[model samples]
Target: MGAYMSEKKYTKDHEWVSIENEIATIGISNHAQESLGDIVFIELPSVGNSVKAKDEICVVESVKAASDIYAPIDGEIIEVNNNLENDAAIINQDAENDGWIFKMKISDSNQYSDLMSEDEYKQFLEQ
Candidate 1:
């Protein structure tokens, strides 16, 4: 597994969010990418799009299947990783870092508290 940031929070759907200065950087968890196999394409939301907690904000296509990537909190998208448009396999190489899908200005920081901690998420995966 790649190095994971201690501050990152994860969703049941296998996305991760790391917040700093009210901006949340979002990405699919390593588990998600591993389950999906070799990712071939990605459909990301445009910058400035409004997304609610649990909203489907993107899609990732892999050799195994296409999966919807959900928002972990309500927010306005501030940026997206355009690099994925050309080489989606970056997700397979490192889902936690360069594979990040987008960044958003969170609507409510409190929403982050509800997400699973790294340990909780690891336990969830074990279940």
Candidate 2:
């Protein structure tokens, strides 16, 4: 894909959030998709659905397992990646970019502080 452009915040659970103009784009990390193995299906939350921090907002099914994708912060979902319905394997191909799951209007800007920076997340993964 294109060069990495966003400053991403990551969770211990393997989700990532990238905010721009109060809209937080959410997706699973590459490490997560690699672990899931050959994603086959995705169930995304509907647009406008209210989600709390840590709520299960979507599901991804792969040949090896099914995993719940959690909301990184309180927000209302404003858009979802419909492309995943037809080709969930995109997640395995590019989990951080073209495979983003949803976009939300963040309810609390401060929640951004709770997530790890790219460097911190890398260290976390090492641990």
Candidate 3:
């Protein structure tokens, strides 16, 4: 998480994604995790599951409550982080990296245009 990395970009509901390639890494944002508190369990969609933008694809349970995690864009889930089943707290440790719940094979990267960039999201948080 040095200069080459980032922990930004946010959805209206507080999910985030960082795309380094054709694949987009997806997860809940720090704000969402903080609100939920002390994650205890996570239910992620199976790899290869097809999900559309805004579709509910996962759930995270924390000391406070259980919450649904939505797909940030239309795509097929390429990978699910098995680490959460054993160590769900990893999401609290690093929501952007180890906490990433899934990797999506976006059907159309252009759809990302509707999401907020890091700068915009940061501004959103301030409001």
**Which is better, 1 or 3, measured by TM-score?**
1
TM-score of each: 0.94, 0.94, 0.89
Model 3 ranges with Cα > 4 A deviation: 1-8
Query: In lDDT terms, how accurate is model 2?
Result: 0.92
Each model's lDDT comes to 0.92, 0.92, 0.85
Query: What ranges in model 2 sit over 4 Å off?
Result: 1-6
Q: Could you list the CA RMSD of all candidates, in the order they appear?
A: 4.3, 3.6, 3.5
- Cα displacement (Å) at residue 10, model 2: 0.3
Order the candidates by lDDT, highest first — what do you get?
1, 2, 3
Measured on C-alpha atoms, candidate 3 has an lDDT of 0.85
